[model samples]
Target chain A: MEPLFLEGKEDTPKIILNSQSNQYLISGRSLPEDATSFYSPVLKWLDEFSTQTVADPNVKFEVRLEYFNTASSKLLLDIFSKLEGLSENGKKVTVQWYYSEDDEDMLEAGEEYSELVDLKFEMKTY
Target chain B: MENNEILTKSMIYDLFKEMTKENITLLYQGDFSQNLMKAILGLTEKKMDNIEVSTNVKKKVFNVLVECVQNISKHSDESKEPPASKFTSILMLGSVNDQFIISTGNLIENKKVESFKSKILMINSLTSEGLKNLYKKIIVGHSLDEKGGIGLGLVHIARKTGEKFEYRFDKIDEQYSYFTLKVNISKIK
Candidate 1:
């Protein structure tokens, strides 16, 4: 499968979904004016990735967003929902949610996502 | 009144004095576009950086500002013809002691005012846990509107700030009303 990489900008997050290299990450700030359009390709790539055979038995998705607006929050849920599907398909999937030590909001956000999604989430603070 | 005297120096000075008294760090009134929104965020980030606010406070301020500005840009009503003033929306960012205040106003159709007000009221009525539950429910179940809004911005804002929103609606004409919303974020964690 082809790797997906989107460079982060002032308002958008960088996304890396490379199954070949086992590197899946979505980080940086996410506050695009049109988040739906901004994340459409990402959702599409995930859909494509799910259909393919899993080379590795374990997948660790990393989320290190500094900040994301509410619209992007919804999209993040969608992304997690897709990940849940992968987990149900017998692949061990884990979400590494990283936040700054002082960012309680980000920590709470990760906790909320953990509750909403079925996958195992590891909360790491730097 | 001559055009030059319309905005007299004394009047400008008075306005400046008022803004200073109010601790307003930024004020803008005009049409809002996506590019302008980006610029506003960038400028506010710089200002916050200069002030050396804590990382958490800065994140909260930036988050609230993004939602408010985007709401104005996306949902604000537009007239069929251009209005004379051309300042259809206004945004003000200020700091008072330990709190950051974000205020935004925009035109909206009068018919939608009741529903908009009710939505805000409902959100304000929720407790922190309730707001969190509502946010999760909406995010998990609701689809984005045609404008890509899932109607979660206000809920998210309420959850983040843990403060009730202050909002007002002023009748502009038979068809339109000016809607204003104010949010406050405490710098102290």
Candidate 2:
């Protein structure tokens, strides 16, 4: 329905969803004080998007997270699983995982997430 | 002494700066009563890569470090002080010659020593591909701890580093043990 956007923090990442453009972006560090509270809404938004998505929706999900803790990694997995499920059900999903050229850990993180899910993922080095 | 603590972290920074020009100085999951462990990991990952390095070396270090930190976060639980106190654990990312090292330390439960030893022994024996296969098996076999299972972390550490993870479980009390594990980050030839 409406746009869903949450800003990133010095310790947390920003989440932006453009329902109109069929584009979603999650960027920054993710170690929220309360992980469940932080991720539940994002999951909810994705669920809603799946239902009210635009015609011929080719969703572009960009992840440029500098870091995420183990707990947040689980949350990201949950989100990707959902996206994977949506894609499996014949929705268009393209994921771009961004990392600085020097950030090996971040790149490997993207690789781990890619391994765990079945989405169209492109690991981009900035 | 309270104010002096800040100097230790600063000194650590200086030491790391001198150790290598790579700037891989992140410490995690120590002493803060809350979620300091996660904070440390979050901060470190932001800068844990060296773009100048090859993809193979980069992947090797990244995987080892993740395993090391996850082990620290999941098992070690020594808070600093005053009952609900914060504690300090140190992680140093540096190179000895050309090989990178990920060192981590935290408090442990004395009783878990045997389990820790066995896991290390088991992990050190596997080849990289074997470790990967084992990880997949664990995932499919539903092997998980109450929080999140780090069974795979050890295997990944062993395989990625191509070296035994050096760990010392020092006894603090009958109930507590201090454990430190170091993983070497050199791609296996």
Candidate 3:
């Protein structure tokens, strides 16, 4: 499978999903004007990644977003739902959500996501 | 001719004076394209960086501002007068005492005013815990509307600001009304 790498922009987040390296990271700001269009490719990539066989049985996905708008919030839930599917298929999927020490909102966002999804979720403060 | 020029100059001066008196940091009125929205956010981010506030508050202001501006861009209706096909809106960001007030006004269809007002009222009626629960429920159950909105922007704003939304709707004509919304975010923890 091909690795997906998209550089972060002023309004979009950086994305890196590699099966061989086993490093799946999404970090930076996400407040695009058209979030649905911005995240369509990402959702497609994740959908493809879920259907394929991978080398690693255990996957740790890291999310370090500084801020994201409400539209992007919905998409993040979609991303987590995809991860949940992978977990149900017997892969050990863990989500490491990182937030700034002073950012209570981000921490709460991670907590809410954790409650909604069935996965090993960890909230870390930087 | 000289009197007309004098009147125009005085009008401009009065506008400046009013804005200054209000302590407006930014004011924009016109079309809100995607590029313009990004530029507005960038400009506000820079302005917010200089303010002596915690990072959390700044992020909250920025987040709320994004939702407000996007709301205008997404839902504001066009005036049916001279310019029949343009979305024109006004955004004003002012600092009052210890709070940052973000105000936006735009044209909206008269038929939708009731629903919009009720949405705000319902959101304002929720406590913090209730707002959080509603946000979770909506995010989980709701999908994007025809305009690409999941209807979570107001809920998110209410949750972040922890304040009631101030809004008004003035009838512009039989078809449309001018809608205004004001959201305040306190700098103090």
Candidate 4:
């Protein structure tokens, strides 16, 4: 599978999916006007990544969203749900959730995803 | 002569003057697009930078602002002819005595008012912990509709600001009503 890299915009996050490193990174603000459309390609790539790879890929997700709107929140959950499928397939999945030390809400958001999905989530503060 | 148009213009002018007198940081009333939203958020971010606010409080205000503006863009009535931009909405941010106020207004079908009122009221009734629990529960059990949201914006706003969502509805006609939502952010978060 080829790597996926999306540069961040003012209303969208930067996404980098490196199959070689088995590292997935998403960072910056996600407040796109059309959350569903903005996230569709990423979702499609993840779906393919989860099902197509034969061997268990050591997958890691680094999420550091400054702020995301409500619509983006649902898409975020979709991303987590797909990653959970990969984890269920016995692949090693680890997630690093980064937030500013002063931002409690972002930390709590990380905790929310951690509760929903069975993945190792490391809460890192900058 | 008391012309209706003249009266309306005077009313709007008075409100504009009041907003200016109150030291509004930003006020925009027009169609809302992704670019517009980004521009507004950028301006607010710059404004927040020069102010003396805790990082947490600034983050809370930014988050609430994002949710409110997007909520209007996603759900507001855009059926008016000669469609202005993409969605018609009003966004205002101001500070009064150190407390920041973020407000958004848009049109909605009259039939939706009751449900929205109930939702806001229920959200306002909850304690902070209750709001957090509701947010968690709703996120887990709820499904996103075609609108691409699980109805968590208000809950998150309530949780972030620890303030009641002050809202109002004005019946424009039998078909539609203008809705406004006001969120107050304290300096301490």
User: Alpha-carbon error at B36 in model 3, in Å?
Assistant: 1.2
Compute the lDDT of residue B75 as modeled in candidate 3.
Answer: 87
The regions of model 1 sitting more than 4 angstroms off are B1-3, B81-87, B146-150
Q: DockQ for each of the predicted structures, in order?
A: 0.71, 0.10, 0.69, 0.62
- List of clashing residue pairs for candidate 4: none
- Ranking of all predicted structures according to lDDT, beginning with the best and ending with the worst: 3, 1, 4, 2
Q: Compose the digit string of candidate 1's lDDT tens values, residues A1-126.
A: 899999999889999999889999999999988888999999999898888787786999999999999888888988999999986677788999999999999999999999998989999987
For residues B1-189, write the lDDT of model 1, one tens digit per residue.
556766777798898899999999888988677788889989988888888678998999889988888888888887664451344889999999989999998888889999999989999999999998988888888667622462588888898899999999988777788888999999887
Q: How well does candidate 3 score on lDDT at residue B117?
A: 91
Score residue A122 of candidate 4 by CA lDDT. 93
Local distance difference test scores for all models: 0.87, 0.67, 0.88, 0.82
Off by over 4 Å in 4: A52-57, B1-17, B78-88, B146-150
Chain B TM-score of all predictions, in order?
0.91, 0.69, 0.90, 0.84
| Candidate 4 residue-wise lDDT, A20-111, digit = tens | 76669999989886788888998899888876664546776899888887778778888888888887776778888999998888998899
For model 2, state the Cα shift of residue A108 in Å. 5.9
What is the interface RMSD, in angstroms, for predicted model 4? 1.9
Candidate 3 structure quality by residue, lDDT tens digits, B1-189: 557854677698888899889988788999788688889888888988888999899999989988998889888988758433354799999999999999999988889999999889999999999999988888888657622362588999999999999999988778888899999999997
Order of quality (DockQ): 1, 3, 4, 2
lDDT of 4 at B186: 95
B33-121: candidate 2 lDDT, tens digit per residue: 23554555455445445334565565456545555655665566664443323345667665665676778777766677888788777
Residue A56's C-alpha lDDT in candidate 3?
78
Interface RMSD of 3: 1.9
Best by DockQ: 1
